[model samples]
Target: MPVELTIHQPSEIFLNDAAVKVKAESPAGCFTLLPRHIDMATALVPGILSYETPEGREVFVALIGGILVKQGNSVTVATQMAVEGPLGDLKNAVDVMIREEDDRDRKTRAAVARLEADFVRRFMEFRKNA
Candidate 1:
């Protein structure tokens, strides 16, 4: 029997498939899960998730961070974001994702600063008028 693998994101399900084996990384270390493995849960770090289909095809998914739960031949991964591709390509994809995330953080900080400056300027104007 194959394990039902489901990868979930905030907006949609990233992947739903059947796999003979699945591997993931956590803060403690890397581990592999088989269909008859004992039930467990792990907190996944930013890393690659790989699995082997019943037909022997291997696939990989790069995830930021998430929670993985295994119960009765079923594996579920809930992550903020994921990118699926070949291992080499996934490495580049992860690098790009990190850069994009950093850029978004910088932009958010700049926007907050502008809003704060505007609020202070308005407050000073109100004081002068009063």
Candidate 2:
């Protein structure tokens, strides 16, 4: 029996297919899952997830850190984000994802700093009026 692999993002399902075998990376190291693999769950690191389809075609997906669960012949990967394409294209996708995340983080930090400054200013003004 082949394993049913489903990759899900926050907004929608990324990929759903039958895979003969699947490979992913975790904190401990890289691991491969077979159809009959024991049920388990692991925290996946940012890396390439590769799987062999029933027709023997290899597919690649670039994923940020996430959780993977294998129960029976079903494997589910839930991540904040994932990009799927040929193996050669995965690297470029990962690079773009990292840059976008970094930009978002920078903007978030700037917003938080402004909010903190405004709160401090208001507190100081209230103290003077008392």
The collision pairs in model 2 are none
lDDT of 2 by residue, 38-115 (tens): 999999988799999999999999998799999998999999899988888889988887888789899999999999
Model 2 alpha-carbon drift over 4 Å, by segment: none
Give all TM-scores, in the order shown.
0.79, 0.88
Which ten residues in a row are the worst by lDDT in model 1? Answer: 93-102
For residue 74, model 2's alpha carbon misses the true position, in angstroms, by 1.5
Q: Mind giving the per-residue lDDT tens digits that candidate 1 earns over 55-101?
A: 99999999987999999989999998899999999998777777777
CA deviation > 4 Å runs, candidate 1:
103-130
Per-candidate RMSD, Å? 2.6, 1.6
